[model samples]
Each structure stands twice: as C-alpha cells, then as structure tokens.
Target: MGLSSRSAVAIHALTMLARWSDKSLTSAEIADSLASNPVLVRRILGSLRDADLVRSTEGRGGGWLLARAAREITLHDAYTAVEAGPVLSRHPHPPSDACEVGRNMQALLEAEFQDAERAMEERLSQTTIADLVQQVLTIERKIGRSAR
Candidate 1:
C-alpha cells in the first residue's frame, strides 16, 4: 500500500558511502547511522553489490565501496536493485467476484498503478546519489548542523 523502507535504506546507505568516499564502510557502520539492524543492512548491501552499486572485500581493512561514482548511480537503480515486485502489489487474493467493485478493482487500478510507477521511476532516474548527498548537506548547512 505504501512505499517500502527498502528504498529509503538503500538511498541512505548510498548517501553515506558518497559522503565518506575515501573509505570503505562495513554494514555495521552504515546500519548504525540508519539505526537499523546490521543484518538488514548487509542484506541490502548484498543486493547493491549484485547490482554493481557496491563492492566488498573480506579481512582486515575490508569493507564495502561504491562500485561506481555516485553521480553514475540513480535512485531508480537503487530502487530496482532492492525491490522484487511492483511498487504496488495486488492483494494476496482477489476480491470476491460477487462484489462488483471487487471484481473490477484490479482492472480499474492497473493503469493508474502503471502510471504511478513510471512517474516514480522517472523522478528517481533524474536524481543521482551525488545529488542526494548534496541535498542532505545543504539541508544540514541551512539548519546550522554539520553534515556527518
């Protein structure tokens, strides 16, 4: 019914990577900033890595790195990487055919859902992770808080 937090988490992790481009970061470190479980962060990171949005290494001095420049990565890319299904998935079971609204609801909403999905993807495509990082820093500066 609503946008999943996966997109938000992916964007946040990407922004953090962009802000700290000089160093690789562990899932635990990124998770701390998100105030989320490291397992969740790692799961997201795994998807990002598979999507070529991030790369990782193991051992001492090992951590995750941006696979490409922040400017080359789009929110749409991140969104697609983590989300497995349509932005608005249909109900688990179709409404009863006995009900007129229930029988036609899916058909009626399909186009609108498609349009919404396209618009969302288009918007996401227009903004890169670098843009997001800049936006965050700008907001912080305006509020007199240092971007960390």
Candidate 2:
C-alpha cells in the first residue's frame, strides 16, 4: 500500500506544536511549513483532534496545540489518527481460486502483509513527537554552528 502523506503532515504538525509549545499555532503557519493550504491542515488537524492528539482554539489570537504532552504522543498515534487500514495493501481483486498459485497467493500475501504492517506499527510506536522535536532542534543547532 502507498504510504499516506497525512501521517507525515500530522507528525510535522505535532512536532511543530511541541517545538513551539509556549504558543498556539495557526493552521496557516503549519500549512506554510508544509507548502500546503490551510484547509488541508485544518482537515488533518480535525482528525487529530478527534483522536485527542490535538486541540484547537478559535477567534482572535486562537489556533492549535497538543491535547497531551509531546512525549505522551507516539508516531503511531499520529499515523492512526489521520490514516486508517493496513499499511500494506492486498491485491485489488481476489486471485482466482482455480489456479494453484492464485489460490494460495491471497492467503500468503495476507500473512506477509500483516506482518509488514505490524512491523511498521511497532517501529512507529517506538517513536514520539518529542523525539522528533529534539531531532529537529539538534539538526538546527548543527546548522547554526556550521553557519557560524
């Protein structure tokens, strides 16, 4: 299955919130970082809000923030919030049962695909938004030092 960009956007947004935890961020700012539009950010943020990973404020001087601590939120949290279904997709149509390989392919693919999906989930769960924020900070620090 194709990896959805939604998960990337959600993680990026969450890391932004954590990095700038002192203040709320408007969707437009996040969108600008993404080179995307506010509408897409809002929609993805909506899904994250529904998952309780994020919260939003409205009106003047209002925007979005994390609902929980960044460390409490895992990459799996972001992935699940915005994307659904298996990370590995099966065949578009069931293989013909008449042929030997076709008959066995679906089952074999299902087992292997599920394993891959589980492995990805395991890896994602191992990481948190806080981890990404720190990585970003470290990279920026290195860049600054090099510039100086």
Candidate 3:
C-alpha cells in the first residue's frame, strides 16, 4: 500500500505555504504548480480545512493559508486528515468452517496489518511539514532554483 496522489498534493500545498510563510495561495496558483485541476486542489483543501491544517478565505484578496506553524504539523497529521480507510487492505476470504487454517487466518492477517499500520504511522508522525519544506529547499538549491 502506497498513498494516493492526494497525499502528495496535500504535502506540496503545505510545503508551498510554509515556503511562502506570509502569503496565501489561491487554488489556481497551487493547481498550476502541482499540474492538477483547481477542483482537485479545492477538494484536498476542503479536507485540510476540516483538519484545521488550513484556513480558507472568500472574496477579493482571498485564498488558503496554513492554519498553524509548519513545525507543529506532522505528516501523520496530514495523512490522518485525508485518509479515509486503513493503510493496508486485506483480502476477504470466506473460509470453510471445517478448514482450521482458513478459519484462523483472517484474524492473523488483521493483526499483522494493524501492526504494519501502526509502524507506518509512527514513522510518519516523526516528520513534520517543516522537515519536508527544508528537504524541498535543499533540492531546489542543488538544482540552482533557490528562491533567492
């Protein structure tokens, strides 16, 4: 199980907001940079807004902005905001009652999947939007595209 593009887009939007620091970004602007539809940006923004990771404005000079400092936001926070289901999917097998292995396998699989998800969440919780922004800036600098 890999994360969806929505995860990448959410991370990018947050990183951009962090880099801008004081400026709000319109969905159009974020869509342009992310090479995705503005509607898609808005959808992701809606989830972020619900999570209190971002705040939206209306009318002129309006857009979206990070609701808090980047350092306070973890990747797991973002993931949790958008995650609709389990991190890993399990196969649904209706085992025969007479089969000993099949009858017990489902429980075992669920336990293993839960453990994996916990481990993944733990790792994600350790990284913040600030960390992602720093890595992105480093790459931009290495490629001579630093904002300076």
Candidate 4:
C-alpha cells in the first residue's frame, strides 16, 4: 500500500528539524524548503506534535522542534503517527463460499499482508530520523549548499 503525502511531509519535516537541532523552524520556513503551503505544514506539524514527535512554541523565535533525539525516532513511528488505518487495506467483498479458493483466500491474503507489513516495519525500525537527516545533509553538501 502506498503511503499518503502527509506521511512523507511529516518525515521530511522531522528530518529537517533534526538537522537543524540548534534552532526551531517555523512552518513558513519549512514550506519554503518543501515548496508546500505553510498552512499544510502547520497541519502536519500539529499531528506530529500530538504524536510527541515534535513540540511547538508560539511568538517570535518560536516554531517547532523534535521532541526527542533523532536517533530515537523511527520511520515506522512517523508512519504510525500519520497513517489513518492499516498499511494495506483489503477488499471487503465476500468471496464465494462455495469455492475452496475463495473461502480460504481471505485468510491467506490477511496473513500475507500482515507478514508484509511486519517486514516493512522491521526495515523501518532499523533506520532512524538521524539516519535520514544525515543522508539529507550529505546530499546538501554534495550540491554545495549548507544543510541548515
């Protein structure tokens, strides 16, 4: 199943915050970098805040920051924070009970999907926000821009 754009955006925002650990980043600034709307950025940040992935501040010199160390945050955690439902949704149609394949396919599909999701989670758990941030920084350096 494909992940929603919100998940991607939230992960990017978190990675950006991790890279800029010394300073907070406003939604406007993040939007500029992501080429997205500031309001959307705020909405994504709001969700992250609720998940305790990020913390926000008001007033001047205020914005958002990672709630904890980047190394402690996994991609699966970010996905779980933004995803609305199961990673892979199945069709609701009841297979023809008369057929053995149809009668058993649902269970098979469910098992397969669960296994796939577990594998994905395992892979994601191995990589943290800190890893993503470092990759981004490396790309920025290769392009001759400071990874702010």
Best by TM-score: 2
* Candidate 4 global TM-score: 0.90
TM-score of each: 0.90, 0.95, 0.91, 0.90
- RMSD (Å) per prediction: 1.8, 2.3, 2.0, 1.8
What is the alpha-carbon lDDT of model 4 when measured against the actual structure?
0.89
Candidate 4, residue 110: CA error in Å?
A: 0.4
Off by over 4 Å in 1: none
Model 2 spans > 4 angstroms off: 145-148
Candidate 2: the clashing residue pairs are: none
- C-alpha lDDT (0 to 100) for residue 2 of candidate 3: 44
Task: Provide the lDDT at 57 for model 1.
Answer: 85
Candidate 2 per-residue C-alpha lDDT over 48-122 given as tens digits, one digit per residue, 9 for 90 to 100 = 999999998889989999999999999999999999777777789988899999999999988998888889899
How far in Å is the alpha carbon of 24 misplaced in model 2?
Answer: 0.5
lDDT by residue for model 1 (1-148), tens:
5578998899899989998999999999999999999999999999999999999989998898999999999999999999877888776788889999999998888888999989999999999999988998889989999845
Order of candidates by lDDT, top first? 2, 1, 4, 3
Off by over 4 Å in 3: 1-3
